[model samples]
Target chain A: METLLSPVVLFFLLGAMATLIRSDLAIPETIGKAMSLYLMAAIGLKGGVEVSQAGFTPDLVLAALAGLALSFLLPVPVFFLLRSIGRLDGTNAAAVAAHYGSVSVVTFVTGVEVLTGRGMAPAGYMVAVLALMETPAIISGLLLASRSGGQALQARGKLLHETLANGSVVLLVGSFLIGLIAGKPGFEPIAPVFEGAFRGILCLFLLDMGLIAARRLRETRSLTPVLMVLAIVFALMNGLIGVLVGAGLGLDAGSVAALGVLAGSASYIAVPAAMRLALPQADPGLYLGMSLAVTFPFNILIGIPIYAAVAEMVAR
Target chain B: MTSRVANKTRLDILVDRPLLSVVTDILHDTRVTGHTVLPALEGEGAHGPWYEDQISGSQRKVMVICVAEPDTADRVLTLLQPLLDSHGIVVMTSQVGVVRGSKFA
Candidate 1:
């Protein structure tokens, strides 16, 4: 309940409600995009700075590999469920699967805020894990999609280019590197933009995200009841898997919670760009609706707190 | 005084921005000489109303316009048919008059 009332989450709820009520409120496109970029850079810089402070550790390596494993493997079960239960075709199933396997950055930021509020901040190096987890799911999704046996698989070269050059990936990894190099003294000059204003920008960004997701919910036609149920189920299962992996790797309680949130959240930004290029036939309404509308809200409202509780229990 | 008018096909495609490259590739492969792409501000469709002002770029649309010779337009359409079928895109073509058909060619 406290999590839901946080200013950022409340702003998100307000945006969703405004859209639901047909209010005329809206943010400009460029500003919203800029806000997203700001959030990414801030998180990356913070992570790099934290890693610098903590020094290199074996645990970071294990956490990273765990992230990679989760990213690559999570989609297999999702693809099968979508095919066997949801009765979706191979292409659509794969597209939606990719979304589940990848992480949502905004959700990650939200988890950090929520946990920090509770006096349990995750390790900064987990930001690197977040970046690492973005692309493997795309590869896993494409490989699964190829089994359907068509020209869709022929774009392997192009898909590789798109995945590597994706704006989110480039910006995130680049910013992290800059943070790593600059360390504390280097980050000092830009702290105001990247640090002081992070929460305010996050509120703005989430508000816009709320509007987008709610509007999409209104327009979504392809998310059938079975798929809807699966969205929630998949999130819970994936989040639990993430928690186990994090614990197995000996992560701290906060880090474990962060991992769970990363695993539980679905990609709405990076994966969709790749899917549109590689799986054009897949219905946007199905994947976008499931990820942005169903899974995203579920994670924010319920999954975060549940994961945090689980992490606390396991750590004790 | 009269102005010269030559027949040309105008192709208009409203598609997601990220896939604009794929659409443009099809046009280039079909031998189109020139095209224009405009950012879509907002609109309604099977997925309801959407605007460019969202945090995620998935829902944003771009409008690509191409004026080309009839045969070139036909070829472009042929290549784009499968993509159009698969993606949530709107493609329309109409008979248009151009002052310089050679430019389009």
Candidate 2:
């Protein structure tokens, strides 16, 4: 109950309600983009600082590899299931597959906040893990789509370019490297700006996100029951996989919950743009609504606690 | 003496998924050979910026560019009107010199 009433969750609910009520509220695009950059930089710098303190270990490497593997493999089952249940043709299933396979940075960031609020902190290297997990699922999703019916976009080279150069990937990886090089002393100068403003900015971004989600939900008339069930199941399975992997890696409860959030959250920013250019035939509403409207809210509001409890049990 | 040569007709169409095949079939039925479909990134219509990531099997806008004889364009537009009644499409015609009149018509 206390967790549910936290400022972060409350602000998110406020935003969601504001948007649903058709309030004239909005976060400026420029500010939103800047907030995104700030969050990435802050996470990277903090992670770098932690890495400096702890030193790089094999466990870090293993966790990263596991994250990559989950990102690559999770979508295959999702694609197949979507095919059977939704009766989605091959191309559409593959496009949707890519979405589930990828991690949502925003959700991961929210998890970090939830953990931090509870006075629990995850290892900094998780930032790099988050960065690494972004692209593999995309590749796998495209591959699955192509193999299913060979209707994959012919602009392979362009699609590769878009995936690699997507804004989120560049900002995330770049910030991680900056933190790696800058270390603690370097991060100190920018800490006041990046660290201090994070929560307020997150509130703003969540508000916009809420608006987008509400707008997406308006199109729910088109969603079938099968797709809805598939989305919920996939979200749950995704969270479960993250818990198992994080536990196997010997992560603590908070860290494990954060990881679960990462795995369960689908990419709305990066994957949607890539899909637009690559899989134009696939329905956007299905993928976007499932990720944004269904999975995102569920993770933020409910999945976090469930995962947190599961993490505690496993860690014990 | 040069009589007024028939103008070239341009057809632009934005359609959802299920209707894409039908639109293409219309073109095929008309024997209009060459057309290009461009992907729509974001836009506002009856629904706000149609987020492609939201709806199931929903349609994204595709810009289909076709150049044909005025008569053929007229026929195609006439055929497409009913289809576009429920959806969205734009049609326009302009006078232009065709390098090969026979090939175009």
Candidate 3:
């Protein structure tokens, strides 16, 4: 309940409500994009600073391995389930499955804020874990597509370059490096922008996300009832898998919850772009509608707290 | 009173920004002299309404315009045929009059 009432979450709900009511409230596209960039950079830098303070640990390596494993494997079941239960084709099932296996940066950032407020702040190196988890699913999804035998495996060879060199990945990994290089004393100068103003800016970003997600819900015709139901199902199931892995690895409760958050969150940004290029025949409406409209809102609104509770249960 | 003009085929391809390269590659492969790519602000199609937004990196559309000889335009269309439905590449062709036919050809 407290998580739902947080200012950031509240702003998201407000944006969604404003859209649903057809209110004239709007954020300019450029500004919304800028806010997203800011949030990414801020999150990356903070994570880096925290890592620098803690120094490298064996646990970090364990978490990275866990993240990579989840990213590579989570899509297999999702691919089959989407084919059978959701009644989707091989191409689309692969596309949507790739998304469920990947991570959403915004959702993780939101998780950090909520978890910190609850005094369960995840370890800083989890940022690296978040970054590592972003792209492996693309490869996994492509492999699944290959099995379908329908030119669903066509890789124009641009996917690897694009996925790795994507703007979000570049900014995140780059900023994290910079943060690591410039430890606490070096970060003092910019703390005002990255730390002091973090929550306020997050509120702005979530407001824009709310509008986008809600509008996507309204405008997209690709979402069938089964796809919609499966979106939530994927979040819960994937999220629990993450929680279990994190707890089994003996990570802190906050870190375990963060893992769950990352696992549960779907990629509307990076993976969607890759899907558009790699799986051109796949419907954007189905993938985007499922990730952006259904899963995103559910995670921010309710899944965060649930994951935290589960982490506490299992990790303790 | 009017300047002399030559008949040409104008191809305007509307495709998502990411796939713009694929479309351009087809034009290049077809030997179209040159083309102009314009950022599309907003429009609606069989899928739905789309507009420019930097975040998702997918919805933004670009209009690639190439005026060329009929043969060149035909080759471009032929190359783009497979992608038209699969990639949502919208190619519009019309007979047009160009003042500098040699420039486009």
Ranking by TM-score: 3, 1, 2
Q: Write the per-residue lDDT of candidate 2 for residues A1-316, one digit (tens) a residue.
A: 7668977778778878887888988665456666667777777777777787778988688778888998999999999898888888897788788888898887888888887777666778888888888889889988897788746364577668877887777888887777778788888898888788888777777766676677677655546777877787888898888988889888766767777777887887778667755676666667877887778887888887777777778853
Put down candidate 3 lDDT per residue, A146-216, tens digits, no spaces: 78763554446777788989888898998898899999999999999999999999999899889889988
Best by lDDT: 3
Residue B85, candidate 2: C-alpha displacement in angstroms: 16
| Shift of residue A98 alpha carbon in model 1, Å | 0.7
How close is every model to the real structure, measured as TM-score? 0.95, 0.78, 0.97
- Considering chain A alone, report the TM-score of candidate 1 relative to the true chain A: 0.98
Candidate 1 chain B least-lDDT 10 residues: B50-59
Give the 10-residue window scoring lowest on summed lDDT in candidate 1 chain A. A148-157
Clashing pairs in 3: none
Candidate 1 Cα errors over 4 Å, as ranges: A148-151, B1-3, B46-50
Q: Which candidate is the best by TM-score?
A: 3
What is the interface RMSD, in angstroms, for predicted model 2? 8.3
Question: Which docking band does candidate 2 fall into?
Answer: incorrect
**Local lDDT at B46 for model 1:** 68
Would you list the C-alpha lDDT of every candidate in the order shown?
Answer: 0.88, 0.75, 0.90
Q: What is the lDDT of residue B96 in candidate 3?
A: 94
- Least lDDT summed over 10 consecutive residues: which range in candidate 2 chain A? A150-159
